[model samples]
Target: MTTYNLARYPERLAVVQLGPGSEVPSWAESSSVFSITATSTETSIICASRSVPAKTRHHRPYTAFAVVPDEGSADFDIASGVTGVLVALLTPLADAGVSVFALSTFGTDWILVHESDADRAEEAWRRSGHTVAPATPA
Candidate 1:
């Protein structure tokens, strides 16, 4: 088994909505960013940021927010974070009856949990041998 150091940074997980006629805010727009396919019904968007965007992408229709740490670092979790260590992380959450929206960059992994499950999920990861910090509000 390999050990990993996880750094929980100060960040928030928020939801954004974009309706048929709505456009996303400039600040919210980024190439690495992803949005669920647009639908007539409300779509859920999970955003991780230090502060709430001034303008939310219009009519997200549905939104789910979580306490996202600024950023969490896990070493050798994947093939240089280019692949999907996140898939492995989320698999456990799913097995434990938790749903998560996960993202990863070249350096770290971010997991967005339902606000209700934040604490539970945090503890779960810690007990599973991953270093994790308590989620903090920003």
Candidate 2:
């Protein structure tokens, strides 16, 4: 597999869950990197650069890494038919002993690591021959 370029989002992110019938929260829209997934049973929102308010009734917060390629438009596409792409991208982190939580949409994937592991994770990706840069504005 070819080496992939990556950008690290400056914001700290959280993954939150709300009831299926609940309205989208106002904060979600303002997030730098936001993704919403809804199903009959529940809704999951990934909010970057901000944390869901403690008062908001939701699942526990999970810190995110919010990585993507450096050269594409915000909605960069990853070929679904490609094999081992994710494995190649994540192997470095695994070798560095950093665990991750991953979320993927049609166009790209976002890998979430604990807030405490962010620095090490970034370093690991860099060491693995991947270029890691600061994320560009949306």
Which residues of candidate 2, in runs, are more than 4 Å off? 49-51, 57-80
Write model 1 residue lDDT over 25-124, tens digit each, in one string: 4455322234444567655454454344557553221213222323453353464453445554665567678776665544455566666676676566
lDDT of 2 by residue, 3-39 (tens): 6766676666777778997788787744555778889
Weakest 10 consecutive residues of candidate 1 by summed lDDT: 60-69
Per lDDT, the best of the predicted structures is 2
RMSD of 1: 7.3
What CA root-mean-square deviation does each model show from the true structure?
A: 7.3, 3.5
Whole-model alpha-carbon lDDT for candidate 1: 0.50
Give the winner by TM-score. 2
The residue-level lDDT of candidate 1 at 64 comes to 30
Residue 13, candidate 2: alpha-carbon lDDT: 70
